[model samples]
Target: MATTNVALQPKRGRPSLARASAIDRVILERARDMFFADGFDAVAMEQVAAAVGISKGTLYARHASKEALFTAVTLDMIAQHSTEAARFDHLLTDDIEQRLRHHARMMVNSLVQPDVRSFQRALSTVQHRFPDLAASISEVGYRYMVRIMRDDIIAAAARDDIPVRDAEGVALMIVSAIGGYQLYETSTGKLTHEELQAHAERTIDIAMAARSSW
Candidate 1:
């Protein structure tokens, strides 16, 4: 019997951990867009796989199902927000109003974002089906926003810029006012960037003035 020469090939199965994570990042990016546009009840796993340019099997290897993918996408957003807040957490300047304006602008950016608006719509539509997930995101996102604002409030008051006694309450007022104003502006007619900035500045002024009584 003659031994035949055999070609050796790299075994193809699942990706390595790092590769899988990279692939999952892409999948979640696609999933976020799809879920934002179509909502949880409307988006299908197959659609996400195709959109992500991956096979259903490959996608499933990363996420067990659409719900799992959605959860991952939500978590990804949460992580990104946390990272951004941390990135600028130490930016305490002499201008408390200016800092508040900056925070207001960040809130405005989030509230006025088309993708965020779509995501909010999607969440509201499907929250009934995923009550726990809805509650989780709502609580987490709200607290994250509040925490960001509260930290800034405390910093500014410590610097004697705002003289806010109730840092936590003042932060809530400032954040909510900016967010609510943006939401209103977006729903009515979109405000120009300049107009929104002006509005935010005015709101920050009012919030700081209200702190005088505190």
Candidate 2:
């Protein structure tokens, strides 16, 4: 019997899969830009489809609704932030305090960027309408920062670098301090690079002093 050469057959779905993924990315990038440029309520699904050069049916097939698309864009932003954070890992020093100061400075720098500020303002406008999604986003972003600080505290405690009875509590306080500073900066003018460094150092010092007494 003659055998069919299965290995020579062309793949059926690979090209479509690749094309679909590329289209999805384009949709997200365009949608994010539109949403940021004009707040969420102003950006329609049809607009996103037109921006991506796709049919409204195609956009709806992928995202179902504008709310769902915005959620995806927000999640993508968080994922990008996490990836950017990972890139600074090699720059961390052995000392926990210095490591934390570096992290604080990094957060301040990232948070104050024009693009980040625009996205944040856009999210803030719709937060009341989408409270559940807002809560979820806050939890994910806040917990990620707390977890990083908690791990550092635990490691430093193990090495007797710092005395702390509650690593999680200390981490929360540290993160909260950074957040408070960020809020102040948003209300006031943007901090200079030197001012940002000083704030980070001061926040870390206060946390260290509190931990030492524990």
Candidate 3:
């Protein structure tokens, strides 16, 4: 009779996740700076923690590993770019060429960010060791760019502004052109900000001409 009085155990609920906030974002931004300045391989977890006035354990609690931190940075960069791209949607002009030019300008501006430049350089160095990092970066960076370009192409087609036999192919080519331009610039040397802007504008004009002609 006494054994029959045993109570049932309560079911466990899922653990709550920590959401990114202004304070957390500040910490992550500082971490990204350290990672960029020192390269991912050189920066240590303790360094990141010390930079943010936190302990190693605290940093680990926030981010599981250096790779995770890099992933967060990639995602953050993508989100920032997405927001910038969204603004163009509101101010989109009737001219398809104008839209293409705006997009090109955005792409050039994005690559010039000191942190972005560092991340890309670091990626090239450690891609062999951390293949996943490269893949993740590509997925979040290059792949995302391609998708956005594709959407823009589709939108232009919807408006009858650009004639495309294969919208996806055209979009891929557009992204490739931009990527090629960035790679070339990075390889040669750093161009002055104004020079880079001019180059992007010129490139966009040429690509758009080809697109329209096709």
Number of the top-ranking candidate, with lDDT as the measure: 2
Model 3: per-residue Cα lDDT over 97-210, one tens digit each? 777777767777777766567777766777888788788778877787777667777788779754677766766666677767777777877756677777767766776778
Q: What clash count does candidate 2 reach? A: 0
- Candidate 1 lDDT, tens digit per residue, 1-214? 1121122112378556766666667777778977886678888888877766667887898788777788788878877765665576467566767777777766665555556667767777777888877878876776667776777677767787546567778777766776676667767666666776777788788886776764
Q: Per-model C-alpha lDDT, please?
A: 0.70, 0.77, 0.69
Off by over 4 Å in 2: 1-15, 161-163
Task: TM-score each candidate.
Answer: 0.76, 0.83, 0.77
Residues forming the 10-long window of minimal summed lDDT in candidate 1? 1-10
**lDDT value for model 2:** 0.77
Clash-forming residue pairs, model 2: none
Clash tally, candidates in order = 0, 0, 0
Higher lDDT: candidate 2 or 3? 2
Better of 1 and 2 by TM-score: 2
Model 2 lDDT tens row, 79-104: 88878777888988778888788777
